[model samples]
Target: MTPEDRFPGPELPDSGPRHQPDLDVLPYGSYYEPEPEPGFEPEAGYGYTTTSGYGGARFLEAHWPTASQQAHPGEPVHPQAPAAEDPPTIELGPPLDKFGKPIEELNFPYPQPEPGEAPGPLYVVGDVHGYLDELLAALHQQGLIDAEGHWAAGRSRVWFLGDFTDRGPDGIGVIDLVMQLAAEAAAAGGYCRALMGNHELLFLGAAKYGDEPVQSTAGTASFLAAWRLNGGQQQDLERLQTHHISWLSRLPALALEDGHLLLHSDTTAYLEYGESITEVNDAVHHLLTEEGADEWWDCFRRFTKRFAFRGDAGPQAVHELLGAYGGQRVVHGHSPIPYLTGSTHLDDGTPPHVPGPYIYADELAIAMDGGVTMEGRLLVARLPLN
Candidate 1:
């Protein structure tokens, strides 16, 4: 189907609001997506607030409790023991090159590509969120692509765990590189693929029907409001094209590789949609094709939920999710790792310095969102955890 057919504009009644209202109808200033659970304070060191006043500054603050604090707060909801003892993770070692002298950063120990080799290893990238330069640097550091932004890893597989757009500059540029690499990698015997991040859905909806009201449990809402609230960049929206929209609509919601279930969000809500991984992906993709606004909104809302595999009952949640979907562990990106590390940020308004992927929740789930937008590391780690 054509992109327009797949992403039809919102259906409007005869004499009501326009199906796609002009941007002039909305407020002028940059909008910030409100933090979930207003008035909810984070554990101790990692406190956050949405009402920070500065546009989108609230996103810089940390929220999720560290593994230690997981035992409290949500105890009633997550009553089970932690997933697995925190895996023996490699500490964020020193930086590969001197970016700064303040925080100690661990350079990903990317294996050098052997001469005339096929793909070297399986690696997963954390959220890109429109940081094209950082994403390029990270991939180069991992030796997945060469200096010219071409797929350099002949046989190594690299999977970006979603969130390719929004919040930063060049979201579309990031998607372009990924789409190019997917083709380049396959031609050379390797592969590159992406999951459908919530932002992708937001972009799709906003482009198709800006300001058109969609029914929600809370009331009538529009993708334009939700997108802006979530740090949508107008530049990204302006540069958005039909090809990008089509690419997004076709992205799978979940995948399983080498026993690791790669997903965009941490919630078990994927279960609500389908049983197996393929089934879940198909269900999500199918929902996006429908014309109803509420269905699409509900799909976006479900993918936006986080921390399902956290808290006291985190292990049980992981077990239940694995029981349904095939995977020894769940590797996701939506939730930033530093937020769960606890000792990340101080009260000085400094961004948390993440060294590597935060392996917590008894190691049953691996959080890859290094919080790049939050001034944390843009994580890229190999598979089959060492």
Candidate 2:
């Protein structure tokens, strides 16, 4: 299916009373014009290609669903309203070639480590915002998966940094692939796990509380509205089965492997959840399971915060998280490396080239998100970078 078909334009609503939230108090970050870098011009519709830092008025003005689109209890629906103009077609980079057959040629054979051998090489994947084909290509390139997309690295541990859905054509497809690999990996004496991302929270929230009004700092909002504003795919929503919800809800928010504190977001807001690693994971799990709509929204908002590990105080921020969580370095996937480095555009204005994971914050933080949504690479790298 086309990207437009996957993420349909917002339906226009008839003139009727709508409870619009005050954009000034969006509960998230404030709206501001991003400074132009070389070869980067702000687009008319959405300012940025990647969904890293867009929030507040820009999000509402450009892509908020109308009253009819989000039918609340006792709210009127006008089915005869004229259809709105189609939104500008989003450029999702070049199409990837399909993997026709399982790769029989194994250039890098799976390593056969002894039972007690320090668990095979640990690999970490960056944010995968849909873009299933790109994900498959990256995995295959890393020898993590075969041409058939099954786990090929025997006894190798893989941890995905979440964000399996939204923005692209096949979010559900991405989730299905990850889940399938998890099972296949376990059977092959390896393990493939994932961390919960802000998008995961947003996806689950939208599924659980569709149009239900939740209290927000701005006024009143709903999960469905926020999800759509942040590139929620209609096909993904339609294919969201109960099993998907269960799996997403159970994913831990943080993990530490090979002295790398792996997380989804770059914010220190995780400190609000708990001090210790186990405490943080348990607290997030509890919140996802036992919390109400407002609580869930609050949790989602906090995780959405980014850029904590940037600027002059960036190292201190990473230090705080490391002190609480216990890790030699922080490896995360929320803020794209291009944005983090302030070099999102090249002299020629082409998409930023992300050679590999960016190690910054005095080598205390490593950024893995290759901004695939913006025609960037889907990163799959081995840990403990040299």
Candidate 3:
């Protein structure tokens, strides 16, 4: 069956008045830890053969070619352009009010507050899907960075809802930008972090082992084939480096904050992996490090399931997830909003328009994917609903 057919559409009957949260006051949680910064031990120029082995063979080493043999011009080298000669000074400002928008008069998310208070403002970004130019422009428009491309949103928290690569050009470039922003934001007392999307695993698997055969529900399949079928771009794999693989492997698959359960997909399959957010993330991470091709393929397949919170059963399913994960609402990216509304976009990689993050499933779930590759818009908005 096609991927769309595999994941059935929401079965909820078209009845009842939809309920949406006021979001003026966000529920706070105290459980999450700071984002873990992880990277591979680089040997020579992004790709190198290693002596260590996992799964009874040289895991990543066996798949990559030597540095010189794998060179590609489209690859975005580090020290990303628009590199400012002087870094902009950052000043922690006041906390954002209930609306989740920056207090325009002060030009900050919120006024400076006492220690132990909530962070300035919380923001959620939808599926980027390797649109580096569009991603950069969106961030600039949101005041997250200045014209020279530096982290300028002091004391605000930005959570990327996943899908950093694939489809569009510069997937690796997009990752590098996010990584740089994470460090810069942290140093400035704010933070930028991301969730692990299925594309991440797909890209990693494709790069580490091109055509390794695997057992799938549809019989036999391979990561390379699956990725290419799912809009994976060639330039991304060509520029794939050891550090990128390591970073992607360590990304958490689930997160919770301000009463919203953050994840890459809107599927109930997460329950099959773990009971809690931490357990889910840990289980996925373990799979990456220890599992074989078939296992990884299965993991990727499970992640592709979506529309769990759609039909009459959606609210109940969402409630069950919240009970397990500790959140009042689910915020995710993967299934683009346009698909739900049956809306298409223009030819020039831009949506005719977007109503913004499609809040549905009786308002218990928020969808952020604007399907940039399909010419839909990229969504980035502050959290705490109002």
Candidate 4:
């Protein structure tokens, strides 16, 4: 069965009256099959093909929790059965570089920057929930990567606003690509970094604690159960490696670059961590390493909070975070643009059109998640969006 058949459009609530009449129409545009990359074949059971362009078949829409559903911090927003049974174990083969060569056989030399050289342009990517092909295409479109998917933007920085895994297919693949780009970008005097999204915490919690029960506001729950309920993929867990875990665990929860406070979720729960960016990041890292499952679960719960930067008090929330984090504005990913703008048409069987990042909070915040999971665009845009 296709993605559309397996996961039908969510029954969303009406977003008030609309002038447009309901018509039988496909939510996305024309579809075209792109040639698969060399030595990078699409894996089976991932529910995605090598096809390109926006369409229901290519983009699988996962259920996003509503505010009422996410009322309890620890409780899952959308509790549902697993999409499919546990996938059988399969060999992933040896790790390869962008050129399809074994990484161990390659010697990547670091290129030193000359004196007085300024940093390259800054770019930020929205949440890529396991959509590897879409991520690759977006990066390529922005000239960050070459045709072979290698980092080609010399000295140009890239920041991925987290949620690397879960929901869609090939979450592990997305993580692997980001990790590879980090190394390659560093070697070229540039850097590609990522933030720790709530999904990362969920994924790691599931990996480490599994079915072990944890205390929640809504009673007892397990990380694995919550993870699956929140669009966790079995193949991602199966394909996860030790290195990937370490890298993800080490990702900072917040970043301040070019006067933009980069984060995964727009919630002000970050203030609960610390007063400064360093303190907040260190606190999060400490929690993952030294804290128990309950503490970790609480941290995950807080990070999952969204829309703090909305409503009349939204500007104040942004100000609170900016006052503490020391950035002119906030850039985040967790809350999709459609939800932020209240323009989603899921209730009408239509795909939400996310043109780009949604700038809101009285122009103090920029939401980067283009709602790719809902057949929206996978956004990759330069910093200081105009």
Candidate 5:
């Protein structure tokens, strides 16, 4: 009965193949609840952009066309009423986008979003794969927090776009309400900081009292068996072992603020590390503050890989992460615009029915993975929206 109520999306014109997939690996997810619930959408949210120059870095987002759907590109979503039986998946095998048809009817021109003095109820989240009541009903429908689980009460300024943990089921109560609303948005000045998800580098590369070690050039992959085959939820890994995976390994794949730029997993391997976007997010937070979580699990194994926006390398890998991270636009969360607009894939473990909330290339880039474990929908907003 769902698959976006049976395929209700259409708007092609971007197509694929600038591809870039290879931080190399193997991969794989589940759950709990504590409180918080409502729905989400007050202003706007999501991140990761770096294109412009080199005709958008020529092309490179490969890895067997990211498993399949033949590396999706526009033209073939004509379903509107006939493809609804499966909708709950966790294939984690063949689907990094190539499932196709939904470029958002091309019309690129972008560049007119620089008018901030800072009054935004700032929000940004993606990759809550555990769907804790759809991330508390999108943070109580963006009142930012109310209905229980305290915070600025509703001051809002949240940011998160990382794989808080595999699949879904309270990835530790969504990292305990984003570490208690980044300390109630810096005690109400307003702001939340989160970034570094490839399931937080596959839970610090399978910590069995680990000091570090989650190597991957792609072989024998073990972020604890790809975090228990993609839906890992052993009581949210013992409540993420009382925090301090070195403060989620000092997160920072990217972030700019106000002008927008943030990332979780949108690949292009941040252009092999640096060149701009503040030296590629300060050299990927300075090689995770100087390697050794198995040599930084191959840069969190290619920033938790994803289809460069599905086929013909989706708008030149979103213009090479928005021209090396400048961000007039680019808001990511690994690959979850229902796995980049194919609408639904993943076959047995289930989840992936989205045909709502999107902007894409002309908007410059904004996906915000809202497939919340499969019930779909766990997103928040707020940011330069008019």
Candidate 6:
């Protein structure tokens, strides 16, 4: 019924920094392909009449209201990413030790961050389901952390929207760094806090008690089978632990600071908690901590399952989530910008990608999920990357 109820409270163990390898980095310029924008391709499954396109890129035709409609000062325009300011390329170098291989530890581009210093610039990383290269490049662009995954600037925080595991080769490695960097950044005044992702829950079940069979909305599913299909990388299993589960389990359902609400998925199911923002959040956290049950878990599963921001009435959904969550807009990572931007091409087998950085929906929600699992872009945005 709530996040806390599912997993009782205790300070979540901090996952210290992880040493990892970087392989299959995304080739540079994939996002820069000069093809005519995929806008309004009537033939494409994502016909112009509707908005979603390949890889979750949002088409502006629908989200923008007719000229007669007045706009809110809070609206963040869906502007195109600034002309490609190509970031310097990073080459995978030899590892300093045996912790991870050279390819795994791509060349880091920075002086290690100093503790207690706030990196003037801040970046919020979207889901990084492996694809270390893309992750590195995005960081390079933002200059938040370096290729080495060390803090580039001290005192600057990086909030991950969750789903760091599964669907890729280096889920474990990603968590390791995230956990480590969380402390490293905090030590320097910047912080790295992650949210509870569904994949994280599944991984917890698989590693702690595999094949034992757990209840799933998908029905009688084993954590292992479901995890694998969802991009569970076998190697990440070795890195699972009680700490990761606890931290993830206890992570807040929604975080609001400034004017944006950060959540993993785009549904307003959280509204079930209560009418007021704090009331709903407190209720959700409370249920997750102590009152968990069969139905409680099911509620978490279902709330996490809905992806309402991508539908035709997506703007309305945005209003609902913001209304209940108490934010001007929702900044989320689960829908995979690529999938939200456009429909996936199952036959071709290409990597997922966000058409570009920064998207605004009817000036309501800011979609931060730049899909990286499929050799796509991994985005890092400030609270206002819109």
**Candidate 6 regions off by >4 Å?**
1-121, 215-218, 274-300, 346-353, 358-360
By TM-score rank, best first, the candidates go: 4, 2, 1, 3, 6, 5
Model 5, 106-199: lDDT tens per residue? Answer: 2222222233323334568777755566666555544556677555333334678777765555666666567656655545544567877777
Model 2, span 34-109: residue lDDT tens: 2443555445432244322221101111122222332221112232333232112111111112232222333333
Model 3 lDDT tens row, 241-290: 76666667778888776677888887888899988876888788889999
Instruction: List candidate 3 segments past 4 Å from native.
Output: 1-114, 345-352
Candidate lDDT (C-alpha), each:
0.64, 0.67, 0.64, 0.69, 0.52, 0.52
For candidate 6, write residues 1-386 as lDDT tens digits: 43223322122122332222121111121121112343435445532222443224342223222223423211223433432221111111222222432224333333454443223333567777765555655555555566666765554546787777766667767766776666555545445677655566556656755665556544565556655655667878876665555555555556664456777767666677667655655665566556634444454454444446644456777888777656677778766555455434335654443344445455566666655555445666655432
In model 6, state the lDDT of residue 326.
64
Model 6: worst 10 consecutive residues (lDDT sum)? 24-33
Residue-by-residue lDDT tens digits, candidate 1, 204-313: 88888799988765567789997886667899998876666666777888877666788888788889988887678778777888657778877877777776665555
* lDDT, candidate 4, 1-386, per-residue tens: 64435432222223222232111111132111223335444335322222221111112133222223222221122223222221111112334454445466434554656754555667888988887888887777566788898987777778899898877778999988987887787677777888899899999999999999998765688889888877788999988877777778888888877678888988889999988877888899899999999999989878877777765566889999999877788989987776555455555668765545667666788888877776666777666321
Query: What root-mean-square deviation over C-alphas does model 1 reach?
Result: 16.3
Winner by TM-score between candidate 5 and candidate 1: 1
The clash tally of candidate 5 reads: 56
RMSD of each: 16.3, 17.6, 20.6, 17.6, 22.1, 14.8
Q: Estimated TM-score per prediction?
A: 0.71, 0.72, 0.69, 0.73, 0.29, 0.65
Weakest 10 consecutive residues, lDDT, candidate 3? 18-27
**Candidate with better lDDT, 2 vs 3:** 2
Off by over 4 Å in 2: 1-114, 345-349
Report the candidate with higher TM-score, 1 versus 4: 4
- Which residue window of length 10 is worst by lDDT in model 2? 55-64
Q: Best-fitting candidate, measured by TM-score?
A: 4
* lDDT minimum window of 10 residues, candidate 5: 88-97
